[model samples]
Target chain A: MSVTAAKGFTAAGIAAGIKENGNPDLALVVNNGPRRAAAGVFTSNRVKAAPVLWSEQVLASGQVSAVVLNSGGANACTGPKGFQDTHATAEKAAEVLGRGAIEVAVCSTGLIGVLLPMDKLLPGVETAAAQLSEHGGEKAAIAIKTTDTVHKTAVAEGDGWTVGGMAKGAGMLAPGLATMLVVITTDADVDSAVLDEALRAATRVTFDRVDSDGCMSTNDTVLLLASGASGVTPEYGEFADAVKTVCADLARQLIGDAEGASKDIRIEVVGAATEDDAVEVGRSIARNNLLKCALHGEDPNWGRVLSAIGTTSAAFEPDQLNVAINGVWVCKNGGVGEDRDKVDMRYREVHIVADLAAGEATATIWTNDLTADYVHENSAYSS
Target chain B: MSVTAAKGFTAAGIAAGIKENGNPDLALVVNNGPRRAAAGVFTSNRVKAAPVLWSEQVLASGQVSAVVLNSGGANACTGPKGFQDTHATAEKAAEVLGRGAIEVAVCSTGLIGVLLPMDKLLPGVETAAAQLSEHGGEKAAIAIKTTDTVHKTAVAEGDGWTVGGMAKGAGMLAPGLATMLVVITTDADVDSAVLDEALRAATRVTFDRVDSDGCMSTNDTVLLLASGASGVTPEYGEFADAVKTVCADLARQLIGDAEGASKDIRIEVVGAATEDDAVEVGRSIARNNLLKCALHGEDPNWGRVLSAIGTTSAAFEPDQLNVAINGVWVCKNGGVGEDRDKVDMRYREVHIVADLAAGEATATIWTNDLTADYVHENSAYSS
Candidate 1:
């Protein structure tokens, strides 16, 4: 059901000719509610897209009733004209939904440094608004895709309330929200402040830890909208847990569908002196290209893992470190421990445990193996 | 001529049966000098190899009589046994050369986390020492090859003094000395203090800027030995410039011979508010795998460059950035400028210029393109 899994949401997807190949490239979602509360997070990249800039302001007001999103052009690095186009898109969506322009949000994704086809995009917003229905959520999920092999959606049920979301990303997925556009909805009686806190807490551990390629994009955005249709404001912890569950599900889906990947690697860092140190160490191991290629070839190259760890400022002595691959302690005391041939690598999911042996803090990062197909896909993407 | 191009130096290369394929795997360079003053630099990685740990101590005395290098195994991450083996190798070299064990340095390269074959290596040291000759520098260079396609050698002559060096490295090259074993021999009359300052200054701008694959190795070493045989005490400035030229030459060769790479990218960052910022921006651009792949496909995708620049903490506004590819301005004022089609990328060398429009500081970094062949080579390496 995607976003419509929540009680007070309707959505639609439409083909707007924004994509040259005639794929559906536009989507709209409306929240009919007793309360219009929303929160958002965008890419940490300094060079943000125009739509990201526009939606940031809209989200600042802490209220939103409608959202318009499109794929096929990122509208990034297009200067002042791109900002105007994004503003115009929000205005068109607000007019079609019979709401004020300040109550609308906008998002865009695809090739960077290109302008959107506003002539087609503005009219498609009207068509999408007219076709919005509770059953249109899945279609809306499918519209915002570029290089993604499949659409991703997830939902979590609470006591008389629910949380649901949709995500689209396949490449350039790293920290700062994973280079995607995500829209999550909830049908609980929560204000904008609670929504903001829960969303930030959830994404901090979910989307922020999925580092597919260590390349952060310029047009990433994640928004959360709330409606009072359920009339039940659960405890803050319960609401945050639901949001985290949905975000983790969507983040996992993003990794599973990473571009040209054959294996999804879960790098778990253990026994760190601090959470930040664990995360830094995990990200370093996740970004080691040689190690990723070794894993892709089914070779348990723990030395590459140690080399990656050595490059970081994490707290650990080289001789005190240990590593396990698929539950086999291949490296102990920073040296060869078990026979590398004993480690199995025939599964699509690989688990690597790096023991820093510092204190007790831990962190996990999800990434993919480097492959020839990945090089081919990204090499020919912009051409 | 290589290291032996300078006076009072003798070297030899020998096959020790350490490699399963019977390739030359042992080399010895002896400085038969009136003055044996020396200086050395090593990898900044915390998880250093056993030989690096051993040689760092030898360099502390500021006098080195000989250096023994092997190519069959790196002897890294091997615990106490690895350090003992490194000490044993140095002891054998010192015994054969009639010097103290503390005056001998050892260097190893190849697969990490494995022990060298002591039975073959110790006896091979005797054979290499007996065969040492004034004209054996080329053979010494060849014996240190692991995955390198060619032996690297460079020479810089000043007045009556000469500086010459040999290096071997082909992969795992990044900042902190380019993941190679280098031996520089000079006949100029200089003290250890002068050699230390010159070596550090030379490597800071040359070897430290070559980031081939963004993977720093655990066993990078560069040693400079002065024999004082030429009897020409050149100025420190002239000696330093000569050392820098030789290092630059060898660094370029390492980039040219990077494993499975087809294109060499020279990223130059200009108009930075500080030199550190320029270096940070240049390295960020050079290590961008997406941009490297795009360049491999001959696509002048300036957006990826801007995206990389945005990730750094450099002082530059988004709207003030400009990028040039192969002398064509593809991006101006952070937006699209000239036609990307006008940039020619048909050659093996690709130049990228990023203008921060902040100040006049600049830096250059050399890297290699991401290729399917690189993935294939690394994936099947350790098996």
Candidate 2:
């Protein structure tokens, strides 16, 4: 179950001819309920896509009826015309759903600096609106894929309430929001302020920590919509936890299916002075290209890890650092400790723990190994 | 002519067996002069190599007699034992050169977290000292090679003084000094204070601006030695310009010979509000992996350039950014401008010009294109 797994939600996926290969390229998700409450988070990148700009304004009103997303074009850096196309898309979606244009949110992903096919996209909006159903969540999840090898969806159940989400992203995934497009739905009695607080808190520790390649995208977005059809108010704490669970699950899926990645490396930074310090150290290690390549080669090279940490401003003396790969403490007190040969890395999943020996806080980041396939895929991506 | 192009310097390179493959791995350079003024710059990385720690102390007195460098191992993160080895190497050089240990400098490059073979290293220093010659600069340059395909050397001659230098680096090249080991010598009549001022000013614009792969090395070092053998007290401005020219030439060579790189990309950021902003923008573009890969594939993907800029805090509106790839204005006003098909990227050197349209300041950063061979070379480097 995806977005439609929650009560009072309808979704549809259809081929819009936007993708020249004839794949399903349009997805529509709607919340039909007693309450129309919504919250959204967008890419922090200064050069945002046209849809992201439009949707940010829509979320300002704290309510949304439907979300329309496409996979064939990003509609970014397309000049003023790009913003116009996004406005037209929301108008068309609102007209078909019998809602106001301001209530429709739009998202687009694919190559940047390209204009969407308006003729096909506008007509496909009507087709998707007519086919909307409660069981169309899986198809909707599949329709918003670019380089993704698999669809990502998650569901978290609570007392008399449920939260469901679908995500689409592969490459250009990095912090400040991974290059993703996600839509989440909930059937709980809640206001927009509560939804906003829950969504931000959940995403801050989940999707915000997944950095696949250290390349941020201009089209990243995450939206949460509440229908309030269950007629049962959930404890705010419990609702937020459920949202975090689903978001965390989707973040893991994004890392596992990262383009051209052969190994998914999890880096945990412990003993930091603060959570921010832990995150800073974790991100430094996650973005080190040399370390990622060594992970792909299955070589337990801990020196690169220390070098990467050295570049950061976190509070730690060089001699007070310790690192463990898999289960072996290969480096202790910043020197060689255990035999590197004993650190097995034959599995697809690799775990690394870095102890700063400075404090008690900790953080974890998920990333992928850099392989020849990664270079090949990205080198030929736009060509 | 390399370092020995200066009248008062003698150099030697030898196969000391520090490397298992039996390549030349040790080099010694001596300033036998009326003046022993020196200045040095080291890696800004917090986890410095033992040699960097040792040499920083030696240069504190602004006087040096000899420098001993090894290419087989970088004595970093080896704890007290690594620092002890660096001290012992300096003592050996001082003993052979009839100078104090406090006047001897040391440098090392290659794998980190490994101890040097003091057994072969100390004895090799004596042999190198005995074999030192005024014409051994070429051999000294060749001895410092780790993954470099060719030895890099440059010389600048004034009316009665001359400056010459040699550098060795391939990968793990980034700013905070470009992850390279360099030794420069001058026979001009200049004091240690003057040499320090000139060295820092020249490198701030040259070596520190070349970011090949965005990986900072723990063993980066650059030294400038002055011996008043020429007896020519030239103007300081003329002398500084000569030093900058030679450094710029060497920096270009390092980018051209970067490990596994197919293209040398020069990113020049113009129309910035400040010099620092220009440098920051240029460095950001230089370190962008997606942009580097696109250049390797000979594709003019300007959107990647904008995305990289978006991540920085540089001053510029989104719609005011313009990018030119190889003389083709593919992106203007943050949108598609000239036809991308008109661009031709057939040469080994790729030029990218980004105009922020904010002010007049500009800075250029040189980097290498990302390729599969870079991943392959680094993956098997430690193994």
Candidate 3:
């Protein structure tokens, strides 16, 4: 179950003839609820797609009756025409769902700088709306995939309420809202302000910490909708925790399905002077191509880890740093410690711990190893 | 004509058994002159190699009678022992050349965290010193190769004085003193301060702007030695220009021979509010993995370029940005412009011009496209 796992939500996925390959390319999710509260987080990139620009305005009303997403063309860099297409899409969704146009949020993915086939997409929206069902969450999840090999969805259950989310991203997966589209729906009694607070707090530690390729996308967006169909309002902290749990699960799935990755690496920075320091150090290691390649090759090259840390301005002395990879303390006091050959690398998951020895603050960032397949896949992605 | 193209300098290269492959791994360059003036630049990496730490101290004296460098093991992260090994290497070089230990600068490259075999290295210093000759410049350049496919050398001749240099690096190339070991010799009648100013100025635009793979090494070193043997003091501007020309030539060579690179990408950022803004934008593009991979596939994916520019803090309106690849303006006014199909990408050199439309400042950064070969080379390098 994805968004439809929650109460009073109907979802549908359909082929819109927009993808030349004849794949499912259109998805529609409508919140038929007693309460229509919504919040959204979009890509931090300044060059946003047309859908993001339109959805940003829609979210300001603190109400969303429906969300419509497409996977054949990202309405980005199409100038004024692209924005018009996105506006028209929202209008069509609003008309079909019998709601205000300003209450519809739009999301689009696939090739950048390409305009949507409005003739196919607009018709597909009506078809998707007609076929919408409470059990159509999986179909909606699958329809948003670009290069992803599998669909991703997560659910967190609370007292008489549930939160469900679906995400799609396979590349350009850096932080700052990540390069993905996500939709989370909850059947809980909440206002727009509470939904907004919970969504931001959940995404801050989950989606914002997953940096698979260090390339941010221009069309990333995450939306949360509350229907209040369950009528049971949980504690604010408990509700926020449930939302975070679903987001974290989805974020983990995103990293696991990152394009052409051979290993999923989790970098944990401990003893940082502050949480920001930990994040900065973690991102530095996550983005170091040399270290990523070494991780791919299963070589416990702690020197590269040190080199990456050295590039950061975090508070740490060279001799005070320590690194442990795969439970092996390969480097200690900024020098070789254990025999690197003793480190095991047969597993697909690698854990690296970098101790800054500066303070007690810590943070963890998830990323994937650099591989020839990653290079090959991205080299030919847009072709 | 490498370092020996200038007067009063002799060089030699020899196999020291440091590399298991039996490649030449030792080089020595001596300056027999009426003036011993030297200037040096090293990697900004905080975890510097032993040689960089040692050489940094040596250059502080503004005199260097001899220089020694070796490949096969970067004497970094060996703690006090690594520093001791570098000190011993310099002392051995000084003993062989009959100069003070403080007058000997050292450099080392290859895998980090490994201590050099001092027994073999010290003996090799004597062998290299005995074989030092004016004609050995090319041999010395050859000995410094690590992952480099070929040795690189550049020479610029003035009215009477000349500047010649050698560089070796095939990976881990980035800014803040690129990941390479370079040695330049000049016969101009200039003081250490003048040489320092000229070297820094030359490197700021040349070596410091070449960002191949964006992985800075801990052992980068560029040393300039002036013997004043020509007895001709060229104008400061003329001398600085000559130094910059040679450095630029070497930087281009490094990019051309970058490990597994199928394309050399030159990212020129113009219409910036300041030079810093231009450089920042240029570097952001150069370090973008998705754009590099797209370039490797010869795909004119200007959307990736716009996304990269959007990540920078440089002054620019998203709608005012423009990008041209190879001569075709694929993106203009932050939207699709000329037909991307009209862009040609059959050449190894790809030129990308990003017009920020913010101001008049401009900067260019050279980088290599990401490819499968690069992944393969770096993945198994340390193993």
TM-score of 3: 0.99
**What is candidate 2's lDDT per residue for A1-383, written digit by digit as tens?**
99998999999999999999999999999999888899999999999999999999999999999999999999999989999999999999999999999999999999889899999999999999999999999999999999899999999999989999999998778887999999999999899999999999988988899988888889999999999999989999999999999999999999999988999999999999989989999998998888888888898899999999999999999999999999899899988889999998999999999999999999999999988888888889882
Chain A TM-score for candidate 3 is: 0.99
Candidate 2 chain B weakest lDDT stretch, 10 residues: B374-383
Each candidate structure's count of clashing pairs = 0, 0, 0
For model 3, the stretches where C-alpha displacement exceeds 4 angstroms are none
| Cα lDDT for residue B5, candidate 3 | 98
Instruction: Kindly report the fnat of each predicted structure, to 2 decimals.
Output: 0.71, 0.65, 0.75
Query: Worst ten-residue run, lDDT, model 3 chain A?
Result: A374-383
The 0-to-1 C-alpha lDDT of every candidate, in the order given, reads 0.93, 0.93, 0.93
Clashing pairs in 3: none
lDDT of 2 by residue, B1-383 (tens): 99999999999999999999999999999999989999998999998989999999999999988899899999998999999999999999999899999999999998887889999999999999999999999999999999999999999999999999999989888898977999999999899999999999999999999998888889999999998899997799999998998889899999989989999999999999999999998988887788888888898999999999988899999999999999999999999889999999999999999999999999999999988999888888872
DockQ scores of all models, one per candidate:
0.78, 0.74, 0.78
Instruction: Tell me how far the alpha carbon of residue A272 in candidate 3 is from the true structure, in angstroms, after superposition.
Output: 0.7
A70-164 per-residue lDDT for model 3 (tens digits): 99888888899999999999999988888999999999998888888999999999999999999999999989988999999999999899999
Question: Tens digits of per-residue lDDT for model 1 on B305-348?
Answer: 98889889999999889999999999899888899999999999
lDDT at A202, model 2: 89
